[model samples]
Target chain A: MQENILTLRDIVVEFDGERILDKINLSIRDNEFVTLLGPSGCGKTTTLRIIAGFVEPNAGEVLFEGQKINGVPPHMRQVNTVFQRYALFPHLDVFENVAFGLRIKKTPKDELNRRVMEMLELVDLKGFEKRSVQSLSGGQQQRVAIARAVVGKPRMLLLDEPLAALDLKLRKEMQLELKNIQQSLGITFVFVTHDQEEALSMSDTVVVMQDGVIQQIGTPEDIYNEPANAFVADFIGDSNILDGIMKRDFLVSFEGQECACLDRDFAPNERVDVVIRPEDVDIVPTQLGIFTGTVESSLFKGVHYEIVVDVSGYKWYIHTTDNVEIGAQVGLKFGPEDLHIMHKMFDGTTNVLQGEVVGEDEIEFLGVRFTRENLGLPVGAPVRLTFSPYDIIVAPEEDRDATVYVESVIYKGRFSELIVWKDETQLILRTQRDEQVATDIGVDFNFDHIKIEPLGEKADA
Target chain B: MKSKVPAYPYFGWMAVFTIIPMLFVLYFAFIGDDGQFTLDGFRRLADPYMIAIFLKSLWLALLTTIICLLIAYPMAYILSRMKLNTQRTMMLLVMLPMWMNFLLRIYAWMMLLENNGLINKLLGFIGLGPFQLIGTTGAILAGMAYNFLPFMVLPIYSVMTKIDGSLIEASQDLGCNFFGVLRRILLPLSFPGVITGITMVFVPAASTFVISQRLGGGELMIGDVIEMYFVGAEPNFNTGASISLVLMLVILIGMGIMNLFDKDEMEGMLI
Candidate 1:
């Protein structure tokens, strides 16, 4: 087994009272290509910055080769980063830019020239060393950035969306080139990008993040085949996620049909999320299928036909090479191994608070009045309000209605679950932003997300 | 092309306001007072007193440019790093004095530098002398630097702000400490702005007569001599024109030398 080259423990970063990274724990192995994959503002770049020593985590230890390097500056660390925009020195030629690190280390003249020439050759720009970086094309500039970063021969290289600025064909070429370079150099690479395809194709391990929290970390194959949650299943590729109940071990029920699955260890009759990849579903004769549905739309997606089927008012997307007519009765067939069962991210049983209807479309909870629609209950009527923990928005103190004191914060894979209290009432909420324990903050509800049920109706159910 | 039509009026304006005036200066420079061609106007420049005055002007202007640059580079760097709103407010404060009349601003500086003015009064509180600050070379130099500081700052600040911040981070990532980044990246990249700032400050300081007249109390710089020959009791437009032509050539040559340091960047800016 390869030794761990870098380890980030409980890393937390906050900017302007907003948490940008929350308790991120990641370990990168030596000579491994790890990609931090997420959309914009997902803190993937921030994680790369922390590893490159450009950002100081608020609360965490950065262990490089098992030695704590939290306060070490970027220049002192044996890590280099290729900036998102390439950040090639505009004043320097290609040769000088690649020689920057070596010159800074005061390498001897002969070796410096040899190393710079080798790096330029590795980047496939042997004769173009004397060319000004400004005059080069975007793809060429990206190559220079990579060469300049790796020429220092740092233990680890951090690339921040370096290929994002390139054209599609060029980006694809660079992806393979980068993977090749990593293998040849045997240097650990921590790359950050929002391109899912790039991450899947290039990285040995993919760390999927959403809103500053690492949703899942696994090998690319594991991340795609056995996603940890609905978010990962949806983010990794096209999939149909539906609510299902785990009837028993290796068996789940969805759409009023029971189907055998590969998942186990769930309580009987427990609610779960079922994920089926669009490409995994097989179209077959109606009598041979586990379930039948009417094809609503069929699109020619080059290599395959993308068919959307209406399975009891729920759309099931399926991709197949076989063409099926629109509005045709089709049978959906998928193996038990294709059905990925995951524990539901949110359970409706929790985050239910009792409130009184104060006005039309208004309900009062925890001494704060919020405007909610379709209350239907008269004034002074009691109601039970249920909302997803993700809907609880934490606001700054000056912008809040009811002040809540944070009691505890648990770092879920996707968000921070907080147990906060106001007066005598305690509430559980989930947010991407990290809040300090024992601190007072303002709380607000996304009114659109609140589900109101009359008190008497809840008793009957 | 129709696109070229819009530039025609500018060409006309250049001819009337710039080209023709330059021609007139050249014409007058070669003409004698008797309306005949003579080398006497150029010969008069060889006098020791005139040469001394010209050299003094050059030296003072060089000192002023160096002083302004020393003060402005760091100031621009700090300003560039400030928050956008704070940077705007600070820039406004830097430019606030320029909104007033130019002569009025110089007069204000004179008041401050006078022996009994606010500066000396403040110095008196610390038991320092009511020093003779006005009517000295120091006063003239101070006035020139003060008046031209914004010119030195504006270009450098604009350039520094336009510098992609990631370059600094990239440099640091490549094992560059703060000073290394500055020396290798910031200084070389901002060279064009420095050259521009030098041009803007030096040209004005070399030819400025008002600051010396107000602060130096009758000291004769080359600008004062040119002013005397043009509009004094003994007005000599020929000599004045010749001096003006010489000054323009000297400035052009100085700029040409500055361009050698950053030929590509200068061309980039021009294009």
Candidate 2:
């Protein structure tokens, strides 16, 4: 078993009687790189501060080297923190700043001078000993902050979004440099960041949190490839959900279009959603295609063309190499192995509409809703809409009374993300170039496999 | 960065206001009773009593500066750390009574310090001690310290508030404990304010009236001597004016040393 360098057990912190961290449990192995990733107010920063002894948890234990270290003041803890603001001393020069921790510990003068110089050189700021702190740039000031903390050679380092203030390019460079520095020193690091890419790139283990609770903890690839829930899956990457009703052992049908997926076993005839990625939907030539459609829109996406084809009466976004012009007819093809089926997250009975085109951006089908956005469909064009059993979203059961309407569409070179509204809830779906789903064709769901969070609803779909 | 002064670039401006006045004083300083150019006015300052008053004035100013500092250092530190609202309220409270009039404050003190006054009434009721709150060098010192303490404290507090608090933390992180941090970081960083406060305190303490007259009773202070020369048994206008001129010269010399100490602090603040 790996020895835990700094261990936190069921740490609960409450400020003003409101829980910020509700029973958080985390452990760091010796010399390991650990990152806490989450949105703002997710307790990641609070946890880092707890370990650094900057904040005292209301309950539970924090152990350093097997000793319960609760209530130890920040200065006395065998830990150093690099605050988000780079809390460097303004009055002191670089030499004095780095030597600060050493001097506090009363390390001998010769030893102090030697260690300070070595550390400054390590941060590549060797000749800045006599320069005033205010004279340095942001990046250099950040280095000085790092040197100030590490010069003490603490057992663990707590970084609270240290590169958060730097620009994107600087942030990336500093991220690599910080990671390399951690590797060379072989010291335990507990880093906090909201940037998903930063966490994935630098951490040995990634801990994702939300609402002060741990969402998932695993290696980066594991967390990315196998999400614990739909939220984790969607949050980590772009996902397309197609709603369908299960028909066979591993098959599902979406608006009469049959598809197959490899996923958890489900009840035969059970309602479910099939999750598929855009890259998974392969496009072939018209003569060899599985399904047929006419090109509604084709967008060049540098490496690939995002094509929207009108299949039957439905619009399907397809990633293809061939650039089919608008109004040109083409064939669509997909296989059974490309779908990832998951259980339906809601019961949608109000918004299943089957209709004909009425107007450009506005559709008319009784009181059922439509959007003037993303709907570029001509007034008379017929479209047989086909959603991968994955992308059809059912409003959460609690918002049964609420309804979704189309709001807007954003065009990314290869595909466009549709902004849809359900009552007051908003969702952005990265769909492909299409002859808009004429707000007139009127949106209707034949299958109810996919589900989503709606207005005034709780829990992930 | 120092601009060349070009041997008094503002000499013409000074000549218009300062040198013209100095020329008049100089002319008066040299004219004797015989109505001829002589050193009679300057010679009057050489008298033994005049010399005593000069020494007394210097010592009194020095004493007031020291006393103001002793009372102000902690007050300034505490005030700087206080919340803005609290500091402002306390300042108003301290200065409200002051706006009434310096002479009024002194007379009120006289009322309290008299043999049968409010202080004695309180002391007699306590039945413990009959302390003489007035009519001595101690009383004069107390009066000067009380009246001048705010001037000393305000400048220091303003400077203290401006000095970055992180610098002290930096010092502590560098291993200097509380006392050493204050001495090395806070004091030096705020030295200019301290110099200004000291100058402000000493200047008025050396020349203020009423406080000495009422509190010191009959003390032989320089202020008292100046008043005597102006309105005494043998009123000597020439000697009195000469004495005032000498006091002004002494103040100038004191200010020169003060500016020398403050140059670096002034530069630091500018940066």
Candidate 3:
């Protein structure tokens, strides 16, 4: 394995009291292409700036070749950046722009000319050196910016969405060209982009970030095949995420059917988030599959048909070359290897459920009634109820508002966490005493803890 | 045809206010006082006294323009980098003096520059002599620079603010220090604004008679000579028109030289 050329330790950056990077730690290997991938406002650009020394993190240290360079200026750092807009000097010609760094270093005339001409040829701009930057096309300017940054022969190159301003065909062409250049030069390239396909195609390692936190880091194949969490699974590609109960080793149950999986090391009957790629599912006859559902919509998306099936109330996206008609009954089938189970991100504290107002002060959900003051909602109006786990009271008696079956009880540091089911709805709560799995229990809600919000356009007035 | 309609009123106003007056100047420049066409007025401009006055006006204007440029470029660069709200507030302060009457502002400067004025009083308190200040060439130059400083600053600030900030970062990324960035990027990019500022300040400073009269205490300039010939105690419209024609030619020649630096930008400014 190659050695790590750059490392970021607990890097934190804040702007106007808003944390843009939260304790981000990463390592880039020598001659590696690492991509920071996320949507806009996800701090990918800020992370690039931190490495380039254009932005100083509020805390933590940036290590380059085992040296701490916290306050080193950008000019002194052995790293160069190609800005987002290809910020070529408007007043300088292409040759002069590429020669700027060399001229600053006071290189001899013959050597400077030879090196500049070589760089221009590398970017395929052989005879265009004398043209002013303002007169060049966007892709040509992008080439000039690349040539200029790399002409200095820095240890690493940082590209901030260098192809973002080009057209689709041009961007595709540049993406391949950039990858080729990085390989030929043998320089570490740290790229930042919001385009998932671009990141997946160009990088040796993909670091997925969201909301100032690094979600996962692995090779492109590892990140795509074995995502760390639900966010990573959903962000990397089209996926169907569903709530499931891990019955035991190699067995899970969801959508009223039991299926085998490859995940283990969970408490028996534990709640887990199940991810299935759209391309992994195969449509089968209704009576010969694990589950059946009505097709909600089918879109012919180029290479495959994107079919959305309504399994109970949840929509499962399936990509298959076989075309399925909308509103037709269909059965989905997938092997055990296709199922990826992950620990749920939340601690199951907050429960969001859809309900209807039965009266001015009464709401109905999971066949249970709750009363409040000043609901102001008319009868039969749709609403949503959100309550915390602490609001649920589990008791041994069967006289409560709803009867539930205790599915699991796992030991938490402060208390035991319980997952109970009332009909088709799952409720998670904390209890002081251990509860036996598969035992009958009664549950009630604390009316004061539930927050009600009206649903749909009917409440707009 | 429709777009040209709005310009007709402006053309009519120019004919009445500008073109006709210039035609009168041209007519009187070549004609004698007896209304016969002659070169007597042009011949009088060769007098050594009038030539000296012209030279003095040119020298004072050049000095004032140089001083204004030196002070305004840095001020404009700093102001452009300030926060948007602070930039607005600072620009308002820079423009505030123009709101008061021009003559009133010059008189205020006179009171501060006189022998026993506020400035000399402070110098006296600091154990310095009350030197001669008000009736010297320095006073006239000071007044001209003070009045035209905002003109120099406004254009440069407007230009500098439009510069993309990433260009500066790119320079640094390519190993440019602070002074290197300023010299290679900021200076070249702000050239159009500097040219505009020079033209604005120099043209007005070269033609003003009031500052020399109030502050120079009898130091005569070309403007004062033109005034004496046209509207002063001894009025001679012919001689005044010829001097005005000559001054206009000199200023045009200077601007033509300046325009050679950046022709495209100059054309943009002209239209």
Candidate 4:
């Protein structure tokens, strides 16, 4: 509901012939603290640079209060950046550094002194006027950087992970201090960082991005509660997302059982994804629950116990305050409203169907036979199956011939996703903590989870 | 401590080669041949001819140092900002002439500056007059600047390369134009290097006798006066030692003034 201060439309940037930012469109409102949250190489810093006019986008329009600023240099912009490394002038004292911009404008000496002293006090760096920049600690240097950038009274500020170099405690302290400063100054801040906790705790609007594309843009609560896709759900916090079939308005199927969900508005028997937060799952007695599993791991995570239960081949992560023993039988319970459903996205991983076709409507891939639609191909011909990563479940390794090697595992929050290598292609699968990297694991799937297609010339059909 | 013993060799070398020779100079300058101390050697420096040669030497050295700095500062600035590969190649080119024999290099300059030499031949081909450039203060000044220009360039280039790139960018971001950045950031940060370069060029240029002998013709410098006392027809060790001591004192004072400008703590040595 606030007035937009800056808007970027269709921004594209490339480095060394590789696309770093692709058609990024964003709008920052006045006096709002917007944080661009993403992992490294996600082009978050590039986006901040483009807004500050430090970098030019190959094609885009940067509008500042409805005025184009594409050709404006960094010094000419109404925005200033607190660079990640602080970039303080080593030869200058703290006072001179803070008064640099004012001196450049030929401000009177008395006025410059007052303004610099005011900024130094604002950043809690009083009495540091005569101290050289090189003698300050990392936290003090950060304060000097903030003072220098803000003393100019620019309309907007851009910070490219300014707290990234501080220790954890100092970083936490600076996060709250920076937020308070922004609020007091009423300057619209566009902050860039890879730390999700920093973004969610300090920002008014968190723009979650991945691989140069924005996944979702919302308030912190909106981003935390209702993530738009699997990537967003996996990135923001811990969630167990699995492939499900939305049978109807209030029904979905997963793990060979029908479950209830609040999400709806999908075609009958449409492939979808269901996400349930770890904190939402309640631990019940094994006999009194809908599904039972043994607790494979229990880790003390300060406020709660992060317990992983193995239900057949599926690992369900549950966050509970109660202590549970490992290898004990337990049950996971969640209400219908706890589930979130989203459309499936295929990330271009192929499956090799090496089955001896028994009949016209039956096919096999990864040692699992399925009754599928007619392929209209010869019985002995080879066929390939395509499936989304959301459908693949990462499990413990097996010494069987129908297995692939787990090359790597990346722990997002609750569930860890594995990169498995089968033949020469790599496939990503999200699973539990039962598997290690470089171990051969059996690739398992249910009959209803896969789709069949003809090979070679008839592939598009 | 055991670590202090390794420095004994350096102390011994300093005593034998530097300290003792300096003591002998002082002893010879003050004593007559009768083993008695007198002020005669010091009074020899008050001679008007010797005073004129000393003043001329000081003037020429000052000219050479200024010329070298004027040419070297810009060259070093450009070289230091060049790409690493290009800098190495250009640096090799700058140092190539120094690898040759110093006397041979001076002689090469003599052949080019002499009457009807290679340079005059080229000038005559273009109808310019064969000027008397071989035995003038201008020719000696040119030779000294050429010989010591690398000493000026290397130190300034070393310091210029150490100037942080971010400081320049920060100045620009703080609304500094190119000239403003140079004045506020670049010049002050590299002041130590400039001082070192000035000392490096001026000291050797002020005390050189070989270049004066080859190019000064009849006009004598203080170095020529000292050489005449020690190794020329007169061979007066006392007067020669006194003149050399005075020259050393003058160069030391010049270095002390230069060191004052190098107040910023920096490792000013090139190697």
Candidate 5:
């Protein structure tokens, strides 16, 4: 293993009495490219700032090259940062900006010119030396910012959502270029971003975090394949969770159906949740094998056909290359090896039982409603739903959705929320389901997907 | 009803509004006894009495500006470096002096600087005899400096605070120690403010009479010289006007040089 370039041990940060990072322990190795990926408000930015020494950690020691840096100022630290805005001095030209650090160090004029030229070449910004920073385009400005920081030859580089301000194509291009630069230079990079794909695509090690704590730290494949917690699994990628009880080694029951799942440290009748990725699920020709589902809705995304099927009155989602018409019968096929089992953190029993008939294009529980857009379901039709025993959600109250009030409406990035009353069950689906002023909704749920936790562990008031 | 302004006439209007007053001053400068042009006013410009007064006024203005700058630069720097609320409160406090009547403030300073006034009384409390500070060039310069300190401070302070502090940090990071940063970065960056403040304080200080009248016991200055020509001596309007014109020309030429100093590249050096 390479030497640990920087170590953050038991780090805690608090702002105005509210905890932003709690016991965050991260060790970045020499020449490693690590990306901290999370949703906004997950304290990814705070962790980056702590490493940069811009903000003093309330509790934790940041060790650089095995020396504790608790009281080190940002300027004195051997870590340099590229701010999101590129923070280039608008008044300075490209040469001046890149030479800024060197100039501050009082290097000889000839050496300054030589190094600034070398840095400009390193960032592929030759002939841009005389151009004003403000006159450079966004991508060029970003290149200059990179040049400015790296010119200092700091031990570690901290990038705080540096590419967030770029357009889509430029952002994608910058990602590849940044990765190339990191590899070529062999420098330790600790990058913070809310973009999951960018982190997965660029980082050698991806650290997924939530609520100020590291949920999982592993290679991109490890994070994608085996998430440490449900939050990590959900945040890293879309994982369909089913509530079930472990019947025995490799056997779990979900949606009132017993199926084999990957074995975990457990005994018989132990509650567990089985997580299955979307692409891992397959739709076969309609046949009465393990279970059969009716096509409730179908959506065609240029590359693949996404169909929502109603299996045993529960809505089951499947993505496929083959197109199936709405209201058509379909077969669900998945090997037992693909089903990953995780014990519920809250309660022993993972299996929960409750579901309702969902329509084709739209799904409805009691009061909870959802549009089956990509699921390829039909409108106002009875659809059979088949999922693992853990998928169905049997809750005392609704959290992700609303009932009686249609009470609140909120717009989050790529996701939204709604509150409606299903006679008695106030249900919430914190899913990327859009429900507008009067959007039709339907839901065919199964016990397999709703991994059950005990009602006692609702967040403390 | 607003009338449609024809284009050519507007240029004529501009000349009438702005150019005629200058021509009037120019005309008054050379008018003779029969209302003809003469050189008596120009000769009076060389008079030893008049020349002495002019030199005194010029030196006094220069002294006042330099003194004000010496005090105000640090004051402005301290104020701009303070927290926003404190900065604003301090600015208000500095401007408070300007809000009072100028003559009244001068009178108050007179009370402070006079032979048996506040300074002497305070000295008496220290077992020293009463001292005299009023009716002197130093007294006039003090009065001028105190009155103009605000004008000098505020512009410099405005420019100083507008400087992006990150530049300083960048300078330090690049190996510029604090003092080096001040000389290479802070000084050049703040030159425009100096120009503005100097222009603001010096112009009024160069011509004001009341400051010298009360503080210098109605002695001599360019104002005294011009007033002597108009109301004190033989009432020579041509010479008086010519003397005023000469002082005016001197001011204009100094401002022209200032404009040259404040050319394009240095214009951007504000802050």
Candidate 6:
């Protein structure tokens, strides 16, 4: 492995007693372009500020080049920042703004002029030496901010959504320019942005984050093709993730069909999630397709047509060059390699069962007996049993002996949530569907996902 | 009514009060006591005593303006950086004294600085001799600084608060210490406020006869001399008006230089 340039170890941060980043650990290699992609209020900017030493994390160490720099001020660190607003000094001209850091170091006048002019030329602002920073356009000001940051030759550069303020065209142009600058300088760039297109196109590595935790970290292709979980699959790009069961070593069943896949390392009947990219699905003739559906909507997206195909009440977004007329029946075919399997974040079992303590480590519920690690109680003691929602797998009406009545089915943009009632208890599970409310559906889940506790201690409360 | 109705009253007020009074001053400056148009009043400006009074008034005004700026700039800087709620409370306290009559506030200061007054009595309790605290140039300077300080502070505070905080952070990121940021960013950005504050304080301090008469113990400034010409045993309105016109020209020229000094790319963004 290449040498690591920076490492953040167990970094915890809180604002006003609310935890923002919980034990975040990240490492960046030398000369790597890493993008932290997340939504707003996800602590991406806070992480960048912690690296810049503008903010002090309540706990944890920030190591730069194997040296702890917890209390080091920003100027003393070998890192510079290009802020979100392009915080260029309005009082200074372009040349002077770039020359500010060099002047502070007390470099010789001739050398300072040469370096400042060279940096200005790098950013395509060679003749803007005398132009005040306020007179420049948003793109030009961003260039000035970049030039000002890189003129010091810091080991790492931190940019906090620097392209967000620019128009689309300018933002695209600057993204490429910034990537090229980072490569030529051979310095690590920790870029923070909510724009996934920029992250996918510009950076070598993408760190997908949600809330305060990093959901996935991998190369761009790894993050895009093989997302770690549903959150990663939903955030990185357009994906169709549905509930699946690994029927055997190489076969998976989803949408009432068993298909061959390339994933393994699960029990014979283990439940999992399946993510398929929009570009991976091919539109074929209705007879040759594996799953046939009607094209509900078709939008021309410049490069390709984004078609939403409704396959048995499940909407699958497919990007295809073949134009299918709206309301026309179509067929979709995806290869076995296209189906990516992810470990479920939560075991989707929401079962609440009354259990009787049979032994020191065993509990009996629903005429079934199971052993637990910490179910320490006397025999015949009453207990409450529950499970995670992610582990629940929904099957066709004919697949199971017991059926659950759907209480309500609400469709979020990327997926749907089904609150099913069984035995007078509500179990919330996620599926890729437009499943209607008040329907009966068969549900099955893994036995290992179950949790049991004494009746006196309420599980949820 | 037409849109011009409200403006008509203001126009009448301006003509009757401002324009006519200014025209009368000009007329009196150019006319002799015998009712003949002459330059005799202007020539009287060459008198040594009149010139001395004029110089004294200019010096005292300059001193007062410099003192007010020295005290107000730091206070304004501190106030501007405070949270808005605290700043509002502090600003109210700073402006509370201005709501009262100016003469009454001046009299309160006079009582505090009197020889046998509150301050000296408190000092005497500590076995210190009763110092002659009043009837000095320092006393008049103190009064001017105390009276005009808010004028100097408010403008600077307003400008300082409006400065984008990111600019200062950017300066520090560029390796400027606190003092360096102050010199390079804060001071230059607030130069317009400094100019306005100087004009506001100096214009009044330069022409004040009351401060000199009450605090300096009968010292005669140019305003006192102008008053003497207007209300002395033999009043000379011509000389008084001439003196006023000269002082006005001097202030205008000073302001012109200050404007030149403030002209930069940032000036257009300010007032």
lDDT (10s digit) by residue, model 3, range A347-423: 45578889999987999999888888888888999998999888888866757777887655544323556777777
Q: For candidate 4, lDDT tens digit of each residue in B79-131?
A: 88898999999999999999999999889999999998899999999999798
lDDT of 6 by residue, B46-135 (tens): 899888888989999999999999999999989988989999999998898899988887788789889998889999999995988788
Per-prediction share of native contacts kept? 0.70, 0.14, 0.64, 0.34, 0.18, 0.36
Q: Write model 5 residue lDDT over A91-181, tens digit each, in one string.
A: 5578988987887677899988888899899788999998877778899989998988888788888898999999999999999999988
- Give the poorly placed runs of model 1, Cα more than 4 Å off: A349-461, B1-5, B36-44, B264-271
Per-residue lDDT of A159-205 in model 4, one digit per residue for the tens? 99999999999999999899999999999999999888899999999
Ranking by TM-score: 1, 3, 6, 4, 5, 2
Candidate 2 residue A229 C-alpha distance from true site, Å: 5.6
Q: Who is ahead in DockQ, 1 or 4? A: 1
Off by over 4 Å in 3: A247-249, A267-270, A349-461, B1-5, B38-44, B121-132, B264-271
Q: Residue B268 lDDT in model 2?
A: 36
Query: Per-model C-alpha lDDT, please?
Result: 0.88, 0.71, 0.88, 0.82, 0.74, 0.84
TM-score between candidate 1 and the true structure = 0.85
Q: Lowest summed-lDDT stretch of 10 residues in model 3 chain A?
A: A407-416
Candidate 4 fnat reads: 0.34
Per-residue CA lDDT of model 5 for B83-162, tens digit only, reads 89999999999999888999999899899988989998999998997867899878898899989999999899998897
Model 4 residue B249 CA deviation in Å: 1.7
- Evaluate residue B167 in candidate 6 and report its C-alpha lDDT on the 0 to 100 scale: 77
Pick out the ten consecutive residues of candidate 6 chain B with the lowest summed lDDT. Answer: B262-271
Error of 2 at B88 (Å): 5.4
Model 4 chain B: lowest-lDDT 10 consecutive positions? B262-271
Q: Which is better, 4 or 5, measured by DockQ?
A: 4
**DockQ per candidate:** 0.45, 0.15, 0.39, 0.21, 0.17, 0.25
Q: Residue A456: error of model 2 in Å?
A: 24
lDDT of 1 by residue, B98-131 (tens): 8999999888988898889999999999999899
Candidate 5 error regions (>4 Å): A15-18, A241-259, A263-275, A286-319, A326-461, B1-17, B32-34, B47-100, B108-194, B212-244, B255-271
